[model samples]
Target: MPVPPPLRQRILITGASAGLGREMARAWAARGRDLALCARRPDALERLRDELLAATPSAVVSLHVVDVADHEAVDAAVDDAAAALGGLDRVVVNAGVAGGDSLGLDGAEANRTTARTNFLGAVHQAESALRVFRPAGAGHLVFISSMSALRGMGGAMNVYSATKAGVSALAEGLRSDLVGTGIAVTAVHPGYVRTEMASHFPRMLMASDPDRATRAIVAAVEREPARAYVPALPWAALAWPMRLMPLGLYRRVAG
Candidate 1:
């Protein structure tokens, strides 16, 4: 039988204090993988670290409080975390926030924040992870892009969609550049995941739980697929039509 991939390898995840990031940390910890978790909230990180350590005493888990949007802080955090883990086998850049209220006031600031965190922050994490992976010669880089990246969703999600689209492009381009380097890049496009991010949206649109989304993400990373559309069928199907729809119709439908 072929040897299975080792789940004991060191894995680093950002935004692991809550939502999909937290769930991914839990899922990986259950598999006995050593984890280095980062998020803005130290208390939440410490709580999760304690919980995971209590439940899985054999797993090595360390939590760091750092915002991905802070380039210098992320640089230092990633370096220290990788050192603590001896080396990183996988880095999941999951720290992100939805663009500000697209429909109401504060839209401008929200869009700006969205761009800063979603696009620039992702770039920072990817660059930092590559710095580590390039020297090591092998690693996995998992980017948590959204299905919103597939098409421009006008009205409330315009900036959010643009940011995700940018990151998706970044992931694809990096995958091409990393060819034959033994490093794998996986872009995850998840649709309507049930999390605080979707709380403001209509309930009918939500499809999968955070745990379910995390499972798909972890599976995609393990398989080292070029791209993954979570909750597969319907979300994947929506991608093409969204891209081809007339601008007027797309706006009406998305709005």
Candidate 2:
């Protein structure tokens, strides 16, 4: 039998304090994978690190308190984490925030924040990860974009959708650019997931549990899939139609 890929490889995950990132950490720990987890919240990061270490004796967990939006800080954190892990085989850019208001007031500020956190932050994380991957000659990049990127939405989510779209494009471009380098880039477009990030939205809008969504993500990584739509049902079906729909129609349907 062919030898299976080692589950003990070290991986780095941003925004690992909660939501999908937290669940991804749990999924990885269960498989005995070492992790370098980063989030703005130090307390939560420390707690998660402790929990993972306790649950998986074979896995090593390191926690870093840093914000992805801060490019320099993120670069330093990634470098230190990569060093501590000896090297990184995978990096998940999951840190993001939703902005823009339904009322449209202060929309500029919201859009700015959204662009900075969602698009630029992912770029920073990816650059840091790739810096290590390029030299090492093998690694994986997991970008956690949203299903909203498939279509332009109205209401308070316009900028959020735009940022997600940007992230998706980044992943696709990276995949093409890194061809034959043994580095795989996976773009994950997930529908509404039940997490603190979606709490502001109606409960009906939230579709999948974070744990289930994360399982699909990690599975896609292990399989080295090019792109993935979590749950892979209505979401996969809706992607194209949503992209072609008019703004008015999308707003009415999305709202």
Candidate 3:
């Protein structure tokens, strides 16, 4: 059952320059929430903050130039954003890179970058958010894992898949750690959202528009579930059965 979500929240979203992160900022701002936007692209963040402020006069929009891969920087950014927003009620760890070639193709550097950005970067964000939430005893942490996390993927997806699985694990582990605590966490597994992340792919299964995907994700995040498959539909129904598929068949189907 879905419970009533906190309205007019103070949200800090990493990677708010484009794609799902950008759309989520818009969705939250439309609801008149305070936003702390962070991304490597400072110019883009400023534009988005301006747009949000223009659209909703009452919305409190702030920008933080951040690179999530830098642990110390991420920690500082989260603290700064929390202070700017008067304490964060929710933090969305949404920054990630889909860059990586096949492990077989000697793509070690690419694989390393992917792992660093996705897993280590997320660790910094989650830790920082928990610091804010622990004292508040009432906060939500949202991680944007992927449906690819259901199983290990090969080709260029090898590193990406493993990193997402780690992210999901973090959410699951946090659920156990926060038992009896008021803080909440959710891992959102979205299937092929039509953002820059999936734009290069030639064939995408159950592809979803960015706006539509953001709305669904925001809804699930607000509900504060331990885990959720976004744009539920076919994705939610298929999650379990897909996980049960044999590796050989999954590789073929995935490719």
Residue range 112-212, candidate 3, lDDT tens digits:
98899999999999998999899889898999999989898877888898999999999899989998899888999999988887675545888999988
> Where does the lowest 10-residue lDDT sum fall in candidate 2?
197-206
lDDT per residue (tens digit) for residues 1-255 in model 2: 999885568989998999999999999899888899999999999888888888887788888888899999999999999989899999999998886775447677877888899999999999999999999899999999989888766667878888899999999999999999999999999888888987766323548887778787788778878888876766877778888888788777786
Model 2: lDDT of residue 11: 89
Question: All candidates' lDDT scores?
Answer: 0.86, 0.87, 0.90
All candidates: TM-score: 0.93, 0.93, 0.95
* TM-score preference between candidates 1 and 3, better one: 3
Model 1 lDDT, full chain set = 0.86
Q: Count the backbone clashes (under 3 Å) in each candidate.
A: 0, 0, 0
* Tens digits of per-residue lDDT for model 1, 163-254: 99999999999999999999999998998887887676533264787777778778877788988888676677787887899988876776
After best superposition, candidate 3 residue 205: deviation in angstroms? 0.9
Worst 10 residues of 1 by lDDT: 197-206
Sort order, TM-score high to low: 3, 2, 1
Q: Which model is ahead, 2 or 3, in terms of lDDT?
A: 3
